[model samples]
Target chain A: MPPTEDPDAISKTPPEPPAPLAFDRPAFHQQAAPEFACALCGAGLTGQYYQANGAPVCSDCRWKAEHESGPPQAGRVGRFGKAALYGLGAAAAGTLVYFLVLWGTGYEIGLIAILVGWMVGKAVFSGSGGVGGRAYQLLAMGLTYVSICASYAPMVVQGLREAQAAETTAGAGAPEGADAAQGSSSVTRSGSTESFVRMAPNGEPDSQPLTQEEMQAALPLPDDPEQMQPGQTYKVDLASSEEELSPALSLVVFTVVVAVIALAAPFLGGLENIFGLFIIAFGLFEAWKHAARPAILFEGPFSAGAAEATRAPALPEAAEAHGE
Target chain B: MASSADVRSPAPGASHCPACGCESPAARLLCPRCGALLHRRRLEELAAQATQAEAADRWGEAAGLWREALALLPPGSQQHQDVGRRAAEAARKAPASLLDQPPGGAGKMPKILGSLGAVGVALWKLKFVAVFLLTKAKFLLLGLSKGGTLLTMLLSFGVYWAAFGWWFAAGLVISIYIHEMGHVAALRRLGVKASAPMFVPGLGAVIRLREAPADSLEDAEVGLAGPIWGLGAAAACWAVFLATGSGAWGAIAKLGAWINLFNLLPFWQLDGARGFRALDRQQRWLAAAFVVCAFVLSGEGMLLLIAAVGAWNAWRSDATTPNWRILATYLGLIAALSWLAVRVVPMPT
Candidate 1:
């Protein structure tokens, strides 16, 4: 009889080594069956069951346990569209809050606007609850820009109106003092939120000395001695030809520059919003990172003897062939 | 097989034990005889007997004795590995008749090839990940370090200008560059090895320290240097504003002061936290008060973030022992910055 027929010798032979384990770790084995639920998903494992981490696991969960990276994400388009809408809502809300702050404080708080961008990112990511791609990031940024423009519109419109009014009043030959005083007063009074600082003619811009005739014409001295002291020094505005000649060129340049700036404000803003958008993207990336589920683990249930049977070559057949 | 001699302990009157030659009394569970653990001594004796058997070419006896020695030693320890290796060697070299196996085996090539194939497949599967890691390492280890500091600064300036506008971006880049240079200068003065400033595109500049600070005080000095230099640059900007009477220069000066002050906020990875290492508990409280007041007066949302981060750090930094002299210097600097801020935006000229 073959050595296999001898039960004693068969029992004495060592079990085949466990199959080379994945992740370069030692093999796992199950000693006995469990009378409880699946360790991975808490499902009631009935009849034949797989062992995972020394506990019973259902076949479905067993597959997931073997594949540790979790399942591929589902529904890319739907999630991103929802995220975009949420970002839009956040942007609108942020801008409204920014404008309110600007109104209350009489100063544009840019850092607060950046906070809005961050919040918009957080809101959008949470609303979607999925990994976002580049397109989704772009969409968030686009909405941020919309918010920035919307907030700045009221301020920009006010600045434009004041600039136009100042130009017309200057055209109407308002005294240099009146024009300078009025422009400065309007800027300070309106509380324009544009951070665009313009180089307007501050104070009196190095005026030429006035003639006695021009001084008399400029300010009519009060006849009463009580109202005006005889020794009081008086300064007058002079319409110098040289000053007028230079102003035409300077005014043209100034107007052109201001107009160019007014036109390019939105473009420059869009550029800055790129950085803001990048910030929002970073926040969204962080939010999206947490959406992945942890991987489950599975252990095999085969006895040591059974495991040996699976791994060993067909020994009886090979031995018979060798005997032949 | 343990004989009577091997099992027996030395007599109490014996001056010294034979095994380790330690003088001790006999008839103890532990080694009053040799100062060796009784159980451990037996294992060691067994190992010695195994070595003798192996020298005498008694393979089976050596293998069995080595196995006993292995069981007594900690798993994965040097002794365990040595004993296990000797046992395996004895088993392999045992006579074919005793081992019940054919000698001079030659059929292992297929198994060896199978292992090689498995390794190849693993490498193939991990190719993408390997390439990705290699690329990242290349950028970090080689790319940034290759260029001169000035070139890197220029590149950083270009990036900043592209991101922020020319008017705002230039001043900001110069300000940040100056700040990082301050760190480099402080590091040099303290005889610490450090690299020149390297600027990140959207973020600011940083100087890589080749060596760590000698102590918290040294660290505070290195940290304090950045803001001091920055404050100087800002003061210079204020001077330009004074000379030119340009509102743009005034704005830049104000921004410089505000940024330097903000960097003084005590928080992780900020200049403030490192500088805060120099402060005692009272000074920390004073610094906190100052930051709070500055935030309230500034209405800057960035300051709010800094304060939040700073407060969190302060809560967590209980382990740091403070240096009072550094605190006084830091406070003096803060006072100077405050004065500069007032001068920079002195009521509307």
Candidate 2:
């Protein structure tokens, strides 16, 4: 029932307002009946209230009322469209996940935030991967990537220097295999590959592509001398850089450039610590680059880890060949 | 309790328009006794003229020359009006003029921003309850900052009754009118014919230029004319407070600085809004970062939150201005100034 003009309608208030009327009531009701039509937009409305000062203002006008500036003019609705929307949603979801992860696992969500932003930016504005479209994605990715990396520069420099100092001290008291492996690797040329070999408990080649059975064979019986627990490392070996570590000093310049750009944006919202700064910085730079040429900023997706496993080199076979 | 519209619009140049003629401090601009260029000099023309004058010894001729320019016209003249609008416009464009004024243009964008933001704030505020009178008043007052009659804060407190109650409303009138006056002064200083304050609902206040400035440099100053004009008003307030020992004037001074600073925040829907379109991308990014940091520190998370939403909308934010660079300098100056003031003059005592 339309709201009766009677103030007595307060006494006659229905159990509850009719379910929220769609913004356009005329179209909805006119599909079958008569109802209040929006004075401006012609959209229909329910629970239309016609005051003495004016005609019935519907939910549509009401919504417009709620927002005074109104949406952007018909043509320039907003600065962003799909990309901004995607990034905003992604950021929101990513932030939510970080909050949840912090709640569950006490680990920082900073790293994940980096990936979230990258994805959001990439989603709306295609990364360099797209054959077409202005190179906006690449530029944005580059700026953001540089910015994120910059956030950790000061700490990384400090950490790396500390690590090098410890390595020098530890080298004096080295385990036998470490130095020899290092020496061999150093002896290799630019394209030369180095490999490490592992001996089976029984001194076998141990190259049967370790299924659970072969994996179990490498382990001793539970009651025997050598059994490892589930998911535990089995003879792990860490790799050293075939080349000397890329000079940490040089990266500082690139990092600073990113830091400056990140700090420059008007919306430099920081997240959990590292990722937030990086994301905000990246977003700002990306926005900046796009504002400029836009074509130079695009970059395609390039995560080596994301590649299929089959496509990756066969590590075990190579290790075994070295052993033979 | 009387309807303010009842106050006559002052006899056209007989005594003068409200701002220049009336004893009421609320008036900011007045009708020219005879100055009529009606054709405001676009900001671009002013810039072109200012450029032409630069090689000459213009600086040496500043005061006398400016006074001569001002004599060509007259002092000029809103609210729910905002605080910073007048001061920022004045500080930025102290020598507001038409011949010397740049085309500080954005089409209808700023108005849209103001209207949308105001409406959003109102809706959110009234989300708790919706009654006819409540919602009607909400709609009516939502974007009334540019509504003129609502602005009257800068008026003498004794005239609060005349202001129709509510400082935001009164201040809107006083701040906007005074701000426009700053523009009139600047334009006159450049010998550019300019209009008195022109009121626009929701967008606050503006001074129309009736003619262009004599040169390019004048135009640049004219582009900055509005801000300088408003700043001059603030300086006047500051000086009065110091000399007269008026605590109320002190309050106005504090508000003036802060409001101007806020307007120049280099964000959406503010004076910086103009800067957004004009600055480069790198500048904008840096400015964005500064703004976010400032908001977080100032506890304006809601703005950030809204910006997050805006970011989403502007994900395609094709902002191609050196906004960040301009913002960096302006905000840095404002922040430094604010800090110095706080240290030297405790805020509202």
TM-scores, one per candidate: 0.40, 0.26
In model 1, the runs with Cα more than 4 Å from the true position are: A1-118, A130-139, A157-265, A268-324, B1-148, B156-174, B185-196, B200-203, B207-222, B233-255, B265-269, B273-285, B292-330, B344-349
lDDT of 1 at B128: 48
lDDT of 1 by residue, B174-269 (tens): 778667767765654444567767775554666777654534666788899889878878888888888988766777777777678767767546
Off by over 4 Å in 2: A1-324, B1-174, B184-194, B199-203, B208-224, B239-245, B265-270, B292-329, B336-349
- Tell me the RMSD of model 1 versus the true structure: 27.5
lDDT of 2 at B296: 56
Give the alpha carbon lDDT tens digit for every residue of B1-349 in model 2: 1000111122211122221121111111211111112112321233334334433534323323332333232222011011112222222333432333323422333454457797865664454334433433343343345433334222222233232334434444455555555455555554455554555432345555565343323443444444544555566666877898765566665555544544553343344444444444554555555555655555433234323433343343564533344455445544432432232343444
Lowest-sum lDDT 10-residue window in model 1 chain B: B1-10
Write out the backbone clash pairs for model 1: A52-A299
**Candidate 2 global lDDT:** 0.38
State the weakest 10-residue window (summed lDDT) of model 1 chain A: A21-30
